[model samples]
Target: MIIGIDLGTTNSLVAVWRDGRAEMIPNALGHHLTPSVVGLDDNGDVLVGLAARERLITHPHLTAAVFKRYMGSDRVTRLGRRDFRPEELSALVLKSLKLDAERYLGEPVEEAVITVPAYFSDAQRKATKIAGQLAGLRVERLVNEPTAAALAYGLHQSEPESRFLVFDLGGGTFDISILELFEGVMEVRASAGDNFLGGEDFTEALIDGFIDAVGRPRGLSDKAATPALYQALRKQAEQAKRALSSNQEAEMQVLHDGQTLSWQINDAAFQRLTEPLLKRLREPIERALRDARLKAIDLDQIVLAGGATRKPLVRKLVAKLFGRMPAMNINPDEVVAMGAAVMAGLKSRDESLNEVVMTDVCPYTLGVEVSEQIAPNRFQAGFFLPIIERNSVVPISREQTVNTIQDRQQALHVRVFQGESRQVKDNIFLGELTIPVPPKPAGEISVTIRFTYDVNGLLEAEMTVEDTGEKHRLVIEENPGVLTPEEIEQRLRELARLKIHPREHLPNATLLARADRLYQQTLGEERQWISSETARFQAVLETQDEERISAARQALKQLLDEVEGESWL
Candidate 1:
């Protein structure tokens, strides 16, 4: 059976279309939400999800989290004695989710539809697909997160014709999509977002505020804050952020160097701290509305998706901006997964979904870099010539004709890029290819370059020498972020050697890791108590008695919860 996966930045979830609806699959820990964290345990076993997240504080050197922000880049995160690319880390999470889906479905699931941010670039999308490949799953489709959300909502809407906007604010990325539904078709009119802006940024804002307010006064330099202390502060900030969403005030406290640092923030203060991030959210919305050629009053509804949208502050901003309360009938955290499941069903040709048609747009302008003549015998390089404008409907092919700039030019070098900038250097270089032409004077030789963007958002460029009818295709294999077939195979072999921690031990390992992290964060009596309890639990595990071990696990978990408060979920 084909499953749907929401390969998110902070958390990931797997779902499937069963019983005529999308059903979320629980992991080994019996939870639908899995933190997107990866780490290597002391025993050299790979760990993912809660266990890995808990290690961020106690075993910071062996763990990695929030690596999704570096997707499509050359950034490498070092965990334990090895280094990993963002896609490799992501593949580990995908593998865990794939196992969960298989266990839940009672079958071997080999294919999936994964959801990504609407504004993710070509390299990002390619990297996502590569991640899926590494996980032993064929990525059937890479659906846009907002488009998937729209599909989930569109399936239930009774109205045959309506225009709505999807405001998606996840942990590490934000996206805005304007969609119109008519006659069983859901067409994304426009898509825009700040990939770096999300709920995590707000939490980071709180972190900075806490540091400025408390750490600075204590003569704590940025370098003076150790990884464990930073993790503790981040955890506290996350908790405070959630608390402020419902409560008028929240307090963040962290223990560092035998001292307790604390900061209190009210709703008003939290807003002030996150104002810059809030400001970044406006431009994307305005751009989407402008591209769709509609105003706030024209939309029938404003649908909110992604876990970050649950924030009261963000909701207030969206409501004030739109002059209407947004829709939250569905759970924000699960909406994208549900929609991804819907897309999977559609892909499999589920009878109930056969009538629905969904369409998406190219989020950015795609064009070829060109040199324009500025004067006699003088030409300026690095000008961008657009082939397909931003927000144009995708699965499209657009072409542009250009003449050779220099006399006796034998070949035209085409550098493809994606962005709104008029200068090529400012845009994202996708790939380049050289098309040979007969030597001739400037403007005597011309070539037509055509770019075809598929439903999966992959691009194919073909350049044809008009006079000779010679055509050459540009394969985007040179991007540093993308892995070639050979590289993927080699990495697959390498991943095969890394063993995952046994599923049966995950719950116990997760609890122990959490206790360890708490041990590092607490001070005085609390720290001593955690240490004793952790040892007691470890001793109990050595007994090998199922009943006694289970009881001890529960008791220790209760104590940890009491000491650490409720979990972020």
Candidate 2:
């Protein structure tokens, strides 16, 4: 069976095609959402989702979260006794989701469609595909997250001709996509975003405000500090930030290392703290609209997706900017996974979705670096010459020819880059290739560079020396996650050794861990009540009666739901 996965920065989810509809598959915890956290348990076994998230405060040295922002880089996160690359950490999350899917379908699932942010670079997309392979699944395709959300909304099933905008503010990344639907065809006109900006930053802003209100204590320098005050403050900031969505104010009191801090903040103060991040959101929206050559009023609908869109200020800003209320018919947090499932169905040629046709565009300009003479005796060596402009439809090729600058030039070097800058150094360096040219006088040797970007975001460059009729082909394959045959086998063996807790015990473990965390956060009678209920649930689990355990688990979750207000969900 094939399923769809949204490997988000803060949360991850899986879905599949079932009973003629897209259905989200719950994890072992009996919840559709899983916190994107990975850590090592006290017993040294791998812990993911809520279990790991709960331990993040007490075992801050061993847990890692928000690594999605480093997707294509070489950054390593240390989780207890092991250091792992971002993709490796991501693979663990994928493996957990895969296991959940297998358990839910009662089958060995092997293929999946994964979603990435629309503005993700070629390297980032490639890394995501490799993460899937490392988890022992064949990645059939990589779909853009915003486009996936659009599909989930059934924009193609609407009027024959319509224009819409998708403003996706996720946990660790933000994307703005402009799409047009015409005659059962959904075409993405443009895409833009800030990969480093999202809800996490907003939470950090609150942390900054709290620190400003109650001066930073000693021994707290970074997030990695163990037994420090920052983690507790971070958790409280997250809770208060969520509360401000409905409540006029949120109250917080935290004690660490004999230092007591208390504060009460309202919406106005929280807005002031997060105003910078809110401004960052507007840039990409304006850029996407400008690239699509449409005014805000031209859009027929504005659709919001990703968990961050639930914020009231975000919704209000979107409405005011677009002159229309954003559509919320679909749950923002689940829409991307739902759309990814639609893509999976489309991949398998599901009859119900056969009539729908979808297309995507390149998010950035791709070109070669060249030298241009700006003055009689001066030249700029890193000028960027665009072969294909940003937002161009995929599966397209463009060619440009250039002459040798010096006499008897023996070779031509073609350096590829992706960006919208006049200077090549400012852009992302993709790859390069050199072709031997027949010795010739200045301006006598001409070489043609052809850039072909496929629908899967694969870039192929061909350099044909005009005089010799010889060709040099380069398929830029420097993705950090791309593995060689030997590397793949080695990684497969390495991953095989990692163990996740058994499925039957995950729900109980997650609940107990959450209860333990609450016990740490509360005081007086509240703590006593939590302790009593946790002991009762522990006693029920000891009986090992499946039905009784399930009922108790539900009861505990409901009780916690009343106290926590479903903020985590």
Candidate 3:
């Protein structure tokens, strides 16, 4: 059976095509969403989902989440002794979801339809699929998260053909998508976003305000707080933001190092703290609408997705900008998951979803990294593969031909890039793929780089080198950070072979640890939260039957819903 997964930054969700309809398969928590956190133990093995998040307090260095932002970059995170690319870190989370689904269905599930942000770059989309593959699942297709939601909503509502916008303020990324429904196809006209901004940013803004107003323990930098405490504060800050939606004010108190720091923020103040970030929301929304040549009230319907959209500020922003209140009924958090399930149903050829067809776009521009000698001592940077824009239709391939610069250059290299950066160095280099160019006049050798975005948003670069019949294909991916291959290999071997904390006995570890324990003890409200949390944990543990593990997990997770809530009391 085909399943749908929305691999969000702050949270992840899984849904499946089942019993003549698309059904959302909640985690052990009975809730549809699961935090995407992963905790590393003494061994290289990983703990995913709620347990991983729980471990965040006791294990910050070993726990890493929000890696979706680094999807297409060359950064590598070193945990303990091992080196992990952003995708590898993400694979742990994906692997967990696969295990859960298999356990619940009592079958080995293979194919899946994964969803990405409509504004994700080509490389980022490919990385998502790679993560899925690494997690041992076959990626059947890559659908945009917003478009998936549209499919779910549009198919169910059967609204007349018109234009609309999908405002997705997810956990780690924000995507403003303009889509048009015509005939039977829902086409994404344009997409824009800041991949680095999302729900987490709101927490950060709140934290900064808390620090400034209430102040931290003497001599403790906001950075020096323990992993657990920092995690707690961020978690509370998010809760406060949510609380402010209905309540006029939310208060927070934490006693660190015998110092009582207390503060209260009203909805107005909370909005002020996040106002700077809110300013950013307008551009993407407007840009998307303009790209589609439509106004805020143009056609019909404005849908919202992602947990971040739950913020009252976000709703006000959309309502004010669009001159219309967005649609309700769908939970901002679960809608994307629902959409994912619907898309999976479509892929499975489920009759109920046959009317739902989505047309998404390329999120960014694709080009080749090129360097030309402009001066005796300086080189100028440029790129090829122009004309094609990001957020363009996927599963689409294009052939672009170019020639070599130097004569008798038998070995020519093809450097791929994504983004609108004028300088090649500013863009991401997927990898250096070489072609066997025949030794001919400088400009005579010709080669073509075929850029393909499959239905799954996976990219393939096929080089046709005419000179020596040398054809090679390369996948654009993160180069392990600043480490050499030898260093990375040695690091991975050591981390995998021996048990160690992700902090690796570094100075940062001691500082972070000291701050962590301090913060947890001071979080007084956690006492009130203990009973329910314990109950939830115990319920899941009771399902010890191997075949019942999936069911048990779901039970455990039901308690974790509203994870952002402060239990400190």
TM values, all candidates: 0.98, 0.93, 0.80
Query: Can you tell me which runs of candidate 1 are displaced by over 4 Å?
Result: 223-225
**Which stretches of candidate 2 lie above 4 Å from their native place?**
217-228, 480-486, 522-567
Which structure among the candidates has the greatest TM-score?
A: 1
The lDDT per prediction is 0.90, 0.86, 0.70
Decide which is better by TM-score, 1 or 2: 1
Model 3, residue 226: C-alpha shift (Å): 3.0
Model 3 quality (TM-score):
0.80
Candidate 3 residue-wise lDDT, 301-338, digit = tens: 78888888877889999888878888867777777777
lDDT winner between 2 and 3, please give it: 2
Clash pairs (backbone) in predicted model 1: none
Write candidate 1's Cα lDDT for 406-502 as tens digits.
7898888888999999999999999888778999988998899999998888889889999999899986666767888898899899899999999
Angstrom error of the Cα, residue 247, model 1: value is 0.9
Q: Which model scores highest in lDDT?
A: 1
CA RMSD of each candidate after superposition = 1.2, 2.5, 6.9
